[model samples]
Target chain A: MTAAVAEPGPTDAPLLRVRGLDKHFGPVQALYHVDLDLPSGKVTALCGDNGAGKSVLTKCIAGIYQPDHAEFLWEGHPAHIRSARDASRLGIETVYQDLALADNLDIVQNMFLGRERTSRGLLDEDSMERAAGETLASLRVTTVKSIRQPVASLSGGQRQSVAVAKAVMWNSKLVIMDEPTAALGVVQTKMVLDLIRRLRDRGLAVMVISHNLNDVFEVADRIAVMYLGRLVVQGDAATFDRQSVVEYMTTGAAGRPGGPRAKES
Target chain B: MAGALPERAPDLTAAPEAIAAELPPEVVAQSLGEYVRAYTARIRAGESGVLPVIVAMVAIMVVFEAISPNHVFLSPVNLVNLFQQSAVIMVLAMAEGFALVIGEIDLSVGFVGALGAAITVQLVQPLTTNWPWWAAILAGLFACAVFGAIQGTLVTRLRLPSFIVTLAGFLIANGLFLKVLLLGPFSGYPNLAGQSINLQVVYYLMWGSIDPVISWIGAAVVVIGLGLFMWLGDARRRSSGLVAPPVSLTLVKIGLIAVIAIVVVGICNTNRANLGTLEGVPWVIPIVLAVLGAWTVLLQRTTYGRYVYAIGGNPEATRRAGVNLAVVRTVAFTLCSFTAGVGMLLYASLLGGMSNNVQGGQYVLYAVAAAVIGGTSLFGGRGKPLHGILGGLVIGGIYNGMYLQGLSVEWEYIVTGLVLLAAVIIDSVSRRGSSSGSVTRV
Candidate 1:
C-alpha cells in the first residue's frame, strides 16, 4: 500500500487523478474532457444539476460504467478498476444515494454483509456486532440505540451514517457519497453533514456529490462544478463566493475567458 | 478577527481506539426489551415455533386416540404405520424447503417423484435386464438432478418467476410420466418388479434386531453431531468477538434435538402389532435424515447458500454486492427442482411402484404448505430446511390421523387448505408487525 500523503501542490501528485474523462451514450456526450484530482484527506464536492454529469462522473470513478475515454491515476500511477469489487479492493468505497442497505438485516449484519467475518463456517455475529458498535461510536453516531437494530428502523440520517461507517470499516482510503442528505429532515441532514466532516477528520479522502450549495459550503474543502459534460470550474471552496458559483453553474464562463456556457437559470 | 477558520486545528493527540468498551446499561436493557418484543410479535403474527407445531401434532394424535374407543389409532402398529405413511411426504417437504429458503417454490415434486419411481422400476426390472439396484437408484437421482437443473436454468437465466416455471415443469413431468408408462406393457399403470426392489432396500436398511441397533446408533450420531456442531460453532464465534446465541440458548437447542431423537427412537421401538412380523424403524427414515442433513449443510455453510439468501432478500443489493445474481438465482431454482426430483425417488422407493393417479397436485400443495407452515417465509429470505421437516411432519400427521378416522378425502383437502391459508395469513401479519415494530424502535 502506498503511504497516504497529502499533496502539497495542485500538480505535486494526486491520489486519484482523472484526465480527459469522456462518456457517450449514443450521440449525446454525458461527459467531456473532465479532468479532476482527488487528493488524500480532503473533501471534494462534485456539484451539478440533474443532467450536468455528476452521476456520470461518480459511476465512472466507482467502476459502475467504463468511461469512453479517460485515465484513472492512483498515487500518480495508472489504475484500471474493472468492477466495484476491484474499486473496493483499491480502498475506494462508493455510498450511493440508495445506501444499498438490506432493510431486513440488523445493523451489524448489514455492516458486515458480503464480507462477513466467520469462524468455522457459522457467522461471527458477536465480533461483527462489537466491531459495528465500535465503528458507529467512533464515528460519533450516538443516535443509534443498538447495533442489533434493523437498518429499516433508522432515520434517513442514521442510515447514511451507517452506510459511511460500513465503507470506512474496511479501512477505505476514499469514500464517495452521492447526495448523502437529499431525503433527510433538517436534524437528520445536520447529522449527516457532521458525519461528512468526521470522515474527513479521520484522515480519509471524502468526495461528496450534491446539488445543495449549503451542504457543499458546510462540509467541502473544494468544489468541482460540472455542466453539460465538462468541468467548468475547480477551485478552493473558501476562495469562491456563492454568487460566482451560481454564475459558473448556470453559465460555464464565470469570470473566465470565452467558453461555451449555459444561459443563466 | 475573521475567525481564521479555527486555524485548521491539528490533533497532536493520537487517535482513540476504534471499538467502544460498552454502551450505557439503559440502552442495553432497552435494546434487549425491543428484541424480546420483536420475537413475541413475530410468534403471534404466525411464525409458529417448531415446538408448538410438534406439540399441537402430538396433542391431536392423543385426542384422536382417546376418541377411538378401540384405541386403534394409538396402537403401536398404527404408530409405526404413521411413520411409514408420512415418510414420503416428510421427505418431499424437506426437499421443497431447500427451494423455499432461497425464495423459490418447487411445484413439480409430486410428478418428479413419480417419474423417478417409474424410471427406477424400469431400470431394475429383470425383463429390462435389470441393473444393480444401487446403480439404478443413482441413475434415477441423476436424471432428476438434470431435470431440475434445466428448470432452474430457465427460471434463473430467463428471469421468469419460479411459479410459472415450476408450474410448467409440473405439467411436463406429468406428461413424461404418462408417456413413459405408455411405452411399456405396464402401459396404463406400473408395478414393482416380480420381486419388490423397495422391500429389498428396506430389509437391508432395517436388517438388525427388533430394535435395529444401527438405527438407534444412527439417530444418536445425528443428534450428537448436530448438537456439538452448533454448540462449538457458536462458542468459536463468540470467542472471536462475533455475536452468537447465548450458551443457554445453544443448550436448549441441543436439548430439543435430544428429546426429538429419543422420542422418535422410542416410538419406533414400540411393538405396534399383535399379528404380522414387523416392528423396527423403516428403512426410509435414515435415508431421509441423511438427505435432510446434506441439504441443511448446503444451504447454511456454503457461499452458494449465502448468495441465494442475498438474491432472495434483495437481488439488486446482491448484484451491487458483486454476486452474479443470474447464476445464484438459476442455481437456487435448480436446487429446488433437484430436491423435487429427490422427493420423487423417495416416494417411489417407499411405494415400490408408480400409480397413474399419484396425487401429484395434492402432494405438491402439501409440500408448499409444509414449507410455509415450517416458517420458511413465502416472501423468502427467512427459512431453513428444518422448517420443512417440522411442517411436513405436521401435515403428514393430519393426513394419517384423518385417514385412520375414515374421514373423506375431500374433508382432508379442506383441512389441509385451511391450515395452509392460516399459515400464510400468519406469515403476512407477522412480517408486517415486525417491520412496523422495527420502525418504531428506530
Candidate 2:
C-alpha cells in the first residue's frame, strides 16, 4: 500500500522460482512437475499449445489453484501462497485471458476494483481517479477518451491495457498475463506488446503467456515452452529458433532445457 | 497474440512521451463545450441517458390529460394522489431492481411486503407484543432480511437457479403471511384479515403534509444539497485533470431541479381539501425522495454499490478481482427484501391496515414492470435506483388516469401489458445497437 507512484527497484535475482509444481483435478493431472523462473527486470514468455500446462502453472503461481506438490521460492527463499489473497500479499498479480474486467465499470473503477481508496466511509473519487490516470499515463495509454467511460465502451486493446494497469498498480513483484493481446486488432495488439516491453524495462518481472511465436520472440527476453502437462523447454529467447520452439511446444523435444533461446546476429 | 502486429519492431522506436502526446482526432478535447457535444453524440449512439424515460413520462401525461373525461388528471389533488400511490410501488420497484441489476429476481418481495406489514401491525396491536413505531419498522425489515438471507443462501451455496429459489420463497412467504395471522397473532380469524393498522405514525405517512414554512425550508435544503453534490463531483473531476462536464451543463442541471422543486411545492401548497385548506408537500413525498436520494448515493459513491453493478455485469470478472461473489450476491437479496419491507409499510399507510387477502403476487409483477419500464434490463449490468422512481411514477400516473377515465381493470391490464412490451423492446434493441457496434466491424 504505498502510493501507486512508488518506483520499482531493480533486482537481478530471480524474483520467483517455483520448482516441482504439480496440480491434479480429480483424475486428470493439469500440471505435472512444472517449473518456472522469473528474474526481476526481465520479460519471460511462457509458450505452449492448448492444454500445455501453461495456464495451470500460471494459476498455481497466482494461487487461484493450490498446487498439489509445489515449492515456491521468493528471492531464493521458500514461500507459501495458499489462496488468491495470499498471492496478492506476496505481490503476485495475474491478468487472465478474459481481461478480468467488469465491463460495466469505468476505467478508474476497474483499475482499482477491489482495492478502492476510501476516505470518510465513501469511495475517494478524486484520489482513485488521479491514481488511475497516473498509472495509465505511465503506461502511455492515452487513447481512452475519459476515465469515466465504461469498460464495455472501450476498444479491445484499451480493455487489455486497463486490465494490465489493474495488475501493476498494486505493488506487484511478478505480473502473469495470459494472452494479453488476444482478440485485439492489429494496431491495438502492437500497443499492448509495447506496453509489455515497457513493464520489463521498468524493472518488474513479467511472465506473458502466448501461442503466437512472433509475439514471443519480439518482446520476450526469455522463452519457456510447455507440452502436455509438463515444462519441456525453458530458456532465453535467443537460444531457440521459431521452428524449434514450435517443436518443443507440440512434441516436447529440444536441444536443451533451462537456458536462454539461441541468439542470432 | 503479442507480436502478431507487423509494425511491432518499428513501433517500439516511439518513446513513451511521443505515444502519450499523440491523440486521436475524436479524443483531442480542447474545450468543455466539445465534451458536452460528445456527450450528446454518445446518447444518440444508443447509450441513452434518463431522457427517454422522462420523455415517456411526459407523453403519458399529455395523452392522459387529453383523453380524461373532465381533464381532472391535471388537477393538483390527482397529481399528489398519484405520487403518493406511486410511493409504495416505487419502493418495491427499487427493491426488485437491486436483484435485477445482479441478474436475479426476488419473487418473494410482494408477499414479503405483506408479511412485513402484518408483522408491523401485530407488533403495535394488543393481541401480540406492542413495540414502538421505529422499532416495529426495524423489526419488520429485519424479518424480511432474514427471510431473504435464507433464499440467498439456498441459491448461492446449492447453485440453485435464483428463479427457482425465489419462486419457492414467493410460495413460502405467502403461506407464512396467512399463518402469522391465524396461529401467531390473529387466532380469531381462520381466513382473510379484517384488521387495520391505525398507528398514527403509519397512518399519516401519505396523508400527512408538512407545514408551509418547513416545506419551504426543506425544499431549499434539498435544492442546495443537490447543487453542492453535483458541483463537488464536477470540480473534483476538473481538478484531477480528467474531463468534467461544462460548468454551464452543471448550472443547467441545477436550474432544472430548482424549477421542478418550485413547481411541485407550488402545486402542493394549494388547498385541495375543503377542510381548512390542507396544504404543503405530503409527508410521503419527502419520505420517498429521501430514500431515493440515499439509494442513489449508495449506488453511485460506495464500494459495495460498485461491486454490485460489477458483479451483475460479469460475475467471473468480479470474482477474479478478489471480490467475494457469494457474499455480495447474498447481501443484494437481503437488501431487496429490506426495501420490500419498506414498501409494504408504505402500502399499509395507504390502505390503513394489512389484509391477508392482499394481492401480493400481482404487486411483485408490478414492481418488476416498473423497474423495466424505468430502463433497468432483465439481463442486468445496466440500471439505477432512479429507474424505480421514474417507472413508479409512470405506473402510478397510468393507473390513476385510467381510474379517473372510468376504465375497467381489464382495459388497464391490456394497456399496461403493451407498455411493458414496449419497454422491453427498447432495452433489447438499444443493447444490441451499442454492443454489436464494437464486435461486428464488418
Candidate 3:
C-alpha cells in the first residue's frame, strides 16, 4: 500500500508518550503496562478486536478515565490529565464515536458549543459564523451547503467533517478519534480518510481507534495492534502488512522476535 | 509536514470564488426573487414556521366575523377588548415558554402568578400598607422568582422530574393564593380602585390608554426602531462577507412589521368607546409588546438562550461541553416565574382586584394551550416567544367570538381542545418531515 508515511523529525522525543499504563475496572483489568508514542504529523492507528482495550487506552489519554498506574509526557514534559478540562489545557482533543453534537443547533453553534463567543452581552453571530467558515475551509470541507445549516440536516460524512473541524479549531496538538468511520458508508469513509490526512499534514498528532483494517491501512502512518488488553505489536506502517496486523491483533504476535513482524526499533 | 502532501498545497489555497461556488445557491442568494424562492422551498419542506398559526388565526377571524351577531367579532370595540383579555394568557404563555424551551414544564405559573398579584394588591391596599404600586410589583415578582428558584432547585439538584415538582408547586401556590388574598384588609380580597395615585397607575396598566397622538408616535417609534435594528444588523453581516439574508428579504420583513403595527394602531385609535370616552390603544398593548420583545431577545440573541436550547436538545452533549446544566435550568424556572408575575399583574389590573375567586387552574391550562397552539413543541428545544403571543391571540379570539354568539364557555373549551390537538399533530408531522428528507434546517 502507498501509505503517506510521515518522516520522523530530528528530535527523538515524541509529542505524547505513554509509559507503563495500567487501568482496571473493579476486578477486571482493561489495560496492562502499555507503552505508546504519538509523533506530530502522523496518524497512528490503534487496531484491535472487541474488548481489546483500545477504547480504554483512548479514554485514559482523553482524561475520561484515570489509569491506575501510568506516566504521561506531553511534548516530552511530564503532564497530568486528571479530567477532560486538564486534557484540553494540554491541547488534547477527543472526537468520540457519538460526536457529542447538538442536532438542533446549527454548525456555527455546535462548533462553539460550550465556549460560545459573546459581544456586548449578545452572541456575536457574524464573528462566530466567519470563524466557523474559515475552520471548515481550512480543512477542505466543501460538502456542506451552508455553515448555518443545522447538524441534523448534514450527511454522515459532513457531520464527521464538522466534528473533526470542531476538534482541530481548538489548536489541539493531539486529536484522538474513537471509531470515526465505523458508521460511515463507502464514500463517506473516503471523505473522512482524506480529512484524517489533512489533520496529519497540518502537523497534529492523531490517534485513531478503529476496527476496520482497510481504513487503518489507508490513513494511518503507524500501526499498533492490541490483544487481550496488551500492546502486542507497534511499528511504522511500512513494517507491517494487513496479514501481519491481523495476526498480531488476534494471536498477540506475528512471527519470531527478530523477524520483521516483531516490534521494530 | 509541508512536504508530506505537496500535491494538496494548491487545493488548500483555492480561490475564494471557487469555494463560494461550492456553497448552495440559497447561501449566496443576491436577489429578492431568489430569496423568496429559497424561503418557499423551506416552507414546502415542512419548516412551516408561524405560517400555519397565522393561517389558523385568519381562518378563525373570518369564520367568527361571518357568523357573529352584527359581525361584532371584527369591530373596533371587540378587537380592542380582545387584546386586553388576551394579554394575561399571552404573558403566561411566554412565561411557560421558558420551561418548555428547556424541555421542562411549569404547571404552577397560573397560581404562582395569581399569588404574586394578590401580594401586590394586598401591599398597595389603602386600608393596609398603602405601599407604592411599583414597590408592590417588585416585591410580588421577587416572591414569585424565589418560589420558582425553589421548585427549580428541587428539579435540578435532586434530579426530580420537573412535571411532578411543578405539579406540587401548582397545588401549593393555589393554597398560597387563597392565604395571600385573605391577608388583604378587604373582607375577602384586595381591590385596585383605591384612593391612591399609585393604585391608579396599576389600574391603568390594562384599563387605560395613551392619547391618540401619543399612540401614533409610539407605534412609529417602535416600527422604526425594529426595522433599523434588523436592517443594520443584516447589512453589517453582508458587508463583512458573512452569511446574511438578502437585503430585499430584510426589507420585506420590515414592511410586514410596519403593516401589522399600522393595523393595530389604526384599529385601537378609532375610539372604541360607544360613549366617546375611551379611545386609542389600551395601555396593555405596549406592556404586552414590551414583554414579547424582551423575551424574544433573551431567547434568540444570547449565549444563555443557546445553552437552553442545547440542554433541551441533548443534555449529555451539553454536559460534555462543560455547561452548568443545573444552573441554566434553575435560572430558566426563575425567569419563568418572574415573567408569570408580570402576567398576573396584568390579570389583576384587568379585573381591578385580586380575590380567592380567580380561576387559577383554568388560567394555567390556557397558558399551556396558547403556547402549544402557537407552534411551540411540547417536546421542547424548538419554540419562540412569538409563538406564545400568537397562540394567546387565537385563544382570546375564540372566547370573544363565541361570547358574541352567546355560546357557553363549554364550547370554548371544546373548540380550544380541538385546535390544540390539531396543532400538536401538525408540529409532530413537520418535525418528522424536517428530520428526514426535508431540506429545512431543524
1 or 2: which has the higher TM-score? 2
Q: Which stretches of candidate 2 lie over 4 Å from their true place?
A: A1-12, A255-265, B1-36, B126-128, B182-198, B437-442
DockQ of candidates 1 onward, in order?
0.28, 0.36, 0.33
Docking outcome class, model 3:
acceptable
Top-scoring candidate (lDDT): 3
Which number leads on TM-score? 3
Winning model by DockQ: 2
Ranking by DockQ: 2, 3, 1
Question: What DockQ class does candidate 1 belong to?
Answer: acceptable
Q: What is the C-alpha lDDT of each candidate?
A: 0.71, 0.79, 0.85
Better of 1 and 3 by lDDT: 3
Question: Where does candidate 3 stray beyond 4 Å?
Answer: A1-10, A255-265, B1-29, B437-442
Q: For residues B118-229, could you state the per-residue lDDT of candidate 3 as single tens digits?
A: 8888888777798898998999999999999999999999999999999999999999889888774577767888569778888999998899899999999999999999
- The residue-by-residue lDDT of candidate 1 on A208-257, one tens digit each, is 99878999898899888887788887767876667777777776657754
Better of 1 and 2 by lDDT: 2
Instruction: Please report the interface RMSD of model 3 to 1 decimal.
Output: 8.1
- lDDT (tens digit, per residue) of candidate 2 on B284-372: 88888877888888887899988889888888878887789899889989889989988988887787767677789988988998899
User: lDDT per residue, candidate 1, B168-272, as tens digits?
Assistant: 988998998777666566665555536655435523432323355766887888899889989897787656644445565677679988998887777777655
